[model samples]
Target: MIENLWKNIKKKEFSSIYLLYGSEAFLINETKQLVIQEAVDLDEEDFNLSSYDLEETAIEVALEDAETIPFLGERKVVLLHNPFFLTSEKTKSKVEHNVKKLEAYIKEPSPYTILVFVGNYEKLDERKKITKELKKNASILEAKKLTETELKNWMRQRASYNRVEMDEAALETMLQLAGTNLFLLTSEVDKMALYVQDSKLITKEIVEELVAKSLEQNIFSLVDKIITRKIDEALRIYYDLLKQNEEPLKILAIITNQFRLIYQVKGLAKTGYGQQQIASVLKVHPFRVKLAAGQAQKFTEEQLMKCISLFAEADYQMKTGGLPKNMIIEMILFQLNHDLRK
Candidate 1:
């Protein structure tokens, strides 16, 4: 997709029709708008511009509207957003009726009319017959979630493109702390870029102080204590996070997710699965999974199961409001670590 995206964006070779679907609606919509603005002008909108919401209108009505020629122009453009209306079961009759009509029209679509479809936030089922037909007949771009490492690498490229310089460590720290919320991450990076206008290099201090849950130090400290079975030290770190307004449920959730990954690595290593298979299943980089799998071999399955169940109980208690949240978690840390040590 990356290689194709590069070649597809060159205007001279661009496809006239496009179906853009994805979770990242903001970026997708921007790309759609750019295509439209380049295709027509504001003064020509009366003859050229038409937009519809699928929830409100039928496919036949949109097709009829699109096929109508301008009273006074050379070209027409139809913009359909959330055309899921075209695919509804209740509207299936109408959709089939219109799709055939559309295919007929598409075969000899207007030299003056450009049809563009947008489903900004949700995806159209690519596995469906209609989706395949659309793909074969027109251009399609599916914007989806970037992998963790891809997002991290992208941050560096994005910062460079935005005329910002970020230290490699600071960039990596943001990736670990922030996961993959591109909108928020881009905003934070942009703000830091502007703040460091004179200095030119965005430092770790700037990022740590500004970004929420800058976990470079705190997480390392927490991970260290947990790994070494230092219950008291881990408790202090956990409580520090709590006092700073981190939710108890979120902490339990993150640790639980981490443990599950470790569990998978352990199981795969025991069975002699290679690093690539483990990474794909875990959705982590092969090297990281390999390193974790090697480290996982050092811990007994008993320790892994003990940590998992402890977190699970902590989660259950928090969700049910069954006990004093902090105390329950604090006790869990001690009992589990104490058991591991003995």
Candidate 2:
């Protein structure tokens, strides 16, 4: 796990070569910073740290830097960024890279240098000789997206790091409000920790009061309130969105998408598909799938299908010359509320 990697870094356990590749930018950047902090001191950073853009600079240039002796420092850190050549991606750079130099350097890496390759790729071409050689020789770290449980645990750990305590329900509410965006959620967590300073415990009330909901989250809440027969509150949220100048048709489209997700998750669950599995099938984030699954449980398939049909009609009415967009959405919500009661 990443925690183990951090622990090792703290103990000064250094790897000569590290290949960090992934789709998630946050985890990849964070891991890189951690390694740099451990490998190079503040004073030595000027002379000891070197960064190269593989697109602009040849691979041989970075490898040469890696092989050079450190200047006034015990160790050096060479950062090779955007190694697109490792994958099957067509090279857009005019500069030519010597793959043989890279392979040779990997075979005999500098004892005094920490050579790090930052590949912001989902998956590298495994068939390449250089890719295979690097994997065979380097310590690899994958920066993949986290699952729902992992995301929640990350929130708890981050809260603990900031000396704040978050209850489980509070954490869940925060996640719902922020969705699965780690960067946005991290920023929110920092603000929340400061909001409850000295008090130190984050409550569901604190989350509701302070955490800003994304538009998607607000729509989810509106749908939840409508499904549970809180018609007045649901209408209030919709009105507030209109007050903020959000387009009525865009709002309706998102609501339609949400309903579609609920229907899909419900069907997948019936077939013994787990939340993560369903997310994979739908090509969406697992956190979204998990939230939709919860909402799906409150709705029967017939009711969900009816809501979808209502959404389709509302969309058409908005696009064509039927009612005003706001009125159409309002009428749809009112009708949905009436149907739910039946």
Candidate 3:
């Protein structure tokens, strides 16, 4: 975890080589920024900090740069970005990398240099000799997506850092309102911190009043309203969405997505999967799983399945039929409400 890595960096513990590979852009960028802040002095950055895109230059050239001594500092940081050679994905870079050169450098790296290989890829080709050698020798940081527990812990820590206190309810509401996107959550946290700067306590009311819901989230709310038989409120939300110039087809697509998620959640829950486990299995954010689980509780398995089929049909008709999109969606919502009332 980056927190563990940060602990090492805090104690001035340095690694000769760091292989950071991940799909999470926020985590990768934050890791790189923190490393630079900890390792290189601002005044000597021009001379001590070096970055290369492997798509433009070869790995051997970056290795050569890593071998050099720092100009004005005790150590230099070399950032090798987009090392597509590590992944199985084919690259359009005209430059040819010497994997042998990189393998050799890994054997005996410079003590005064922090050689960081940054690949914006999910996984490295494990069968490759060069990939194996780098993993064996360097400090590897995989910025995988965080689980529900991990994200909450992160939020707690972030709240402490920002000098604000967020209650459990407020945090949960924030997660649902912003979804489980780290980048979006981070931005919302900053805004909430400023809003609660005086009182320093982020309450549920504050969260609900301040956090802006994504369109998908609003659709989820619409579903909740429908399930609770508040059809008037649900239609109000739908009208407000239309007022924002949101396409009815787009809205229908999201509604279909919600029904499908609820159906999936119901099936998974029947098999005794908890929210976090279901989230992992479904490759969705934990916050989303939690919300889906709640919605799933309001319907029988049969009802959820019927909802999915109805929306699937709506999706097909919207794409092919000449019917107005608003009417199609209204019919779907009305029929869903009617079905549940039975």
All candidates' lDDT scores?
A: 0.68, 0.90, 0.87
What's model 3's lDDT at 219? 96
Model 3 Cα shift for residue 188 (angstroms): 1.4
Writing each residue's lDDT as its tens digit, candidate 3 over 26-113 gives 8888888888999998999999999999899888888888999888989999999998888899877899888887888899999899
Q: Put the candidates in TM-score order, highest first.
A: 3, 2, 1
Per-prediction CA RMSD (Å): 4.9, 2.9, 2.4
lDDT of 1: 0.68
TM-score between model 1 and native: 0.73
Q: Which lDDT tens digits does candidate 2 get at residues 229-292?
A: 9999999999999988999989998999999999999999999999878988998998899889
TM-score of each: 0.73, 0.86, 0.89
Which one is best on TM-score?
3
Local accuracy of candidate 1 as per-residue lDDT tens digits, 73-148 = 6566688777673343233323333567666655666556667778754446566565667767777767766655
Model 3 misplacement above 4 A: 88-95, 272-277
For model 2, state the Cα shift of residue 280 in Å.
Answer: 1.9
